[model samples]
Target: MRFTPVVALAAFTASTTASVASDRYIVHFADAASARAATHASQFAPTERRLSDAPRHLRSLAAGGEVFELGPDEASRVSALPGVDAVEEDLMFEPTTVVASLWKRQWYMHDPKVGVDAEKAWKYTRGAGAVVAVLDTGITPHPEFDGQLLPGYDFISDAGAARDGDGRDADPTDMGNWSDPGECHSPEGKASTWHGTHMAGLIAARAGNRPGIVGLAPEAKLIPVRVLGRCGGRSSDIADAIVWASGGDVPGVPTLARRADVINLSMGTTGACGPLLRRAIEQARSRGSVIVTSAGNDQKNANTNTPANCPGVVSVAALGRDGAMASYSNFGNVTLAAPGGHIGDRGADDILSTWDIGKRGRERSVFGYRGGTSVAAPQVAALVALMRSADPDITVDQVTQQLVDNARPLPGPCPKGCGAGLMDAGATVDAVVEDRGRY
Candidate 1:
């Protein structure tokens, strides 16, 4: 059995698209003032039939459920209300996965931490105080990440936060594998979830613990924010989670996410980072969180992946075990490459790690091998955490800059996609040391 990340509260069960009809509705108000007004209270007098389940507005509404979804006529009536704003319909799009991870057993890879001719840059740097939010599947509690989770929030349908809903918090093997309710007999094989969980382990798996796998940052804490579920959340939900994780707004959602210095978006949409995602990333950047994302799995040049392609994000490309760029990795503007491993093969696929260990109703063997750039993103994220531990107050931009500055450039057809170069923990540590000395 393969274990990745647990998606929704329902856990193992899957959902058929046709089975659930996504309710489409509209919100109308008197004027721009009323409509754009904060989620606190609608400025206009809402009609009885007009109701809403607006994510941000419910809090200020007197009865909480006072706001209702109304059709056109009701919208028209509400429009006549004193402070009506504009009326708009809610548009929901399917959610997508984002990721990158893994690193171990590579000799040529920079390891200034314990090398004969180790660089002096690492002595002064060690990822001081940066917080990287892992927004993929769910993170399993492993001996490696024992004390690594900082403060995680589950965006899986909003109810099962932290706890997997089985009354326990970290059940490694009980991840929800992806299975398109009606995917079979389609094109690809049956879909499943938990790919996120397995990805998480690759990046932060405990180091030096004599464990199943080694991570990029053995000491870095994880902030598990679950944004995926059975099927997935609409764009709205993902956008909300992105903003909230970076210390932005969401009405009903308590301020669980503090201001993180960095955020790891190991997920992406087939579509680009649309308006909502773009806006959310911009807002979060304004608040100061270094956002890192996986370039994409599409094997095409100039292939732009959402959030990854979004402005001001560090998009990582994937590399095979032997240092050649993974042909499948999306390349145009590759930032750098780290070993993401080759699926179902060894030597050619040394980048491996322990996967979901405790999912329910599944076969006992959850640990297995797989590879890709999705596995590489987290490797960088865990590195960010270690850098934070070394210096907690480091600015998001500064950390990102250091990463770019220190990465060992790779050789390839298009170096652009690989960014500064392959991420080297020891090299990065050395650069930080130099950075601290200059400071």
Candidate 2:
């Protein structure tokens, strides 16, 4: 009744050790003249004589200040000086990489041959006003997602699988999906994936946040639709979520105020496309929602994978830094290929995004690297958002055609067949904007 996610992820290691040297402080003066005069005062003689160099003066500031190293005992002495307004610690600031090196680690957004070239695409549009629905294990709170998430629903019907006690509610927060030994047909227990959070970050993590990697469509809005959880989620629940996300009515569920322009399905099961899912996809497409799906990680014919194999969906295949089909990626029937990274011993090539540090419950937030067609699918979905933002009236068929027509051939080989080609974000957005006569 349920299917597990097709993803491979690794935890990022970080350190919180503090520096043990004397703290630096900035002494603010009531006026610039007072600051200048204080530099020569007897009260400052001790600090001037103790330090190797002169204090850095900030006389141009509205409340002029001076930055200098200060011992705890010396700090108290300076705080009591005449005309000194305030003396505060000069805090050290570093790049966001100190917490998580997502920006530097995101090679898929820059590399010319194999990457999506998202930077070049930004010249055209940032996907403002577009909405994308992420249907997966649900989302977790992260700084990168601040102010970008829309009110979402939890569609997991089974009480045990939902893991929050009772079935289905308004909250779509990921409660952690760690499973026991032999759970969900696995040989051993597994940690919570925090999958939907990662997918959402890849689609639209806030830009200019400085601490995390920028998403493909930084201005787009995300709807976190909870479908998979615990051992996995049922197909029926996923089907219902698809309809609800695209503005279709479901029994006992409130109508969605804003329909998503793109629906991202990053989880799938083996076997033929079932009628239940087919109808949902058809209904979503009829409402102008372009559906995107992962081709699976089973490394076989993707035609045997549901949803990916389903009609009326844009199925994506996984590619590594080499632009070849990933060793773990399923192939045939794929619509496009995108960077999914190959997880080797070092995991240096994996796609890095926002994540959680918890194993089975809520914990501190962090960024991590993940691989699989699940990761690759969101890249296409985000691109679809950009396309929609450029031309709000673009049809679903037009969106799919532009993606296929502008895709570039993979720089590496895919003997088993990958897709139309590798996704070229720059070229694809250019083509769409041009088609709308925006040139």
Worst 10 residues of 2 by lDDT: 5-14
Candidate 1 local lDDT, 1-439, one digit each (tens): 3221122201211221122222333544433334344223433333331233122233223322223344344334443434333444455665331111223343223333211111232354333345567777665555556666676665655333222554222222325535443643355434344565566665455544243554555444556776665545456766777787788867666674467666777666576668888888888888877777887777765245777788878788777655667777777765666656565454524445555443432333334566677777777776666666666656667777878877765633444456677777666766665566455
lDDT of 2 at 308: 95
Clashes of each: 80, 0
Clashing pairs in 2: none
| lDDT per residue as tens, model 2, 1-439 | 2211111000000121222245678877666666555544423343433332223233334444676565554556566655666788878787444222465688888787788988778898889999999999999999899889999999999989999897989999999899999888999999898999999999998745366777899889999999999988899999999999999999978889999999999988889999999999999999999999999999999998988999989999999878889999999878989999976553769898889999889798888889989999999999999999988988999999999999998889899988799999999989888889532
Best by TM-score: 2
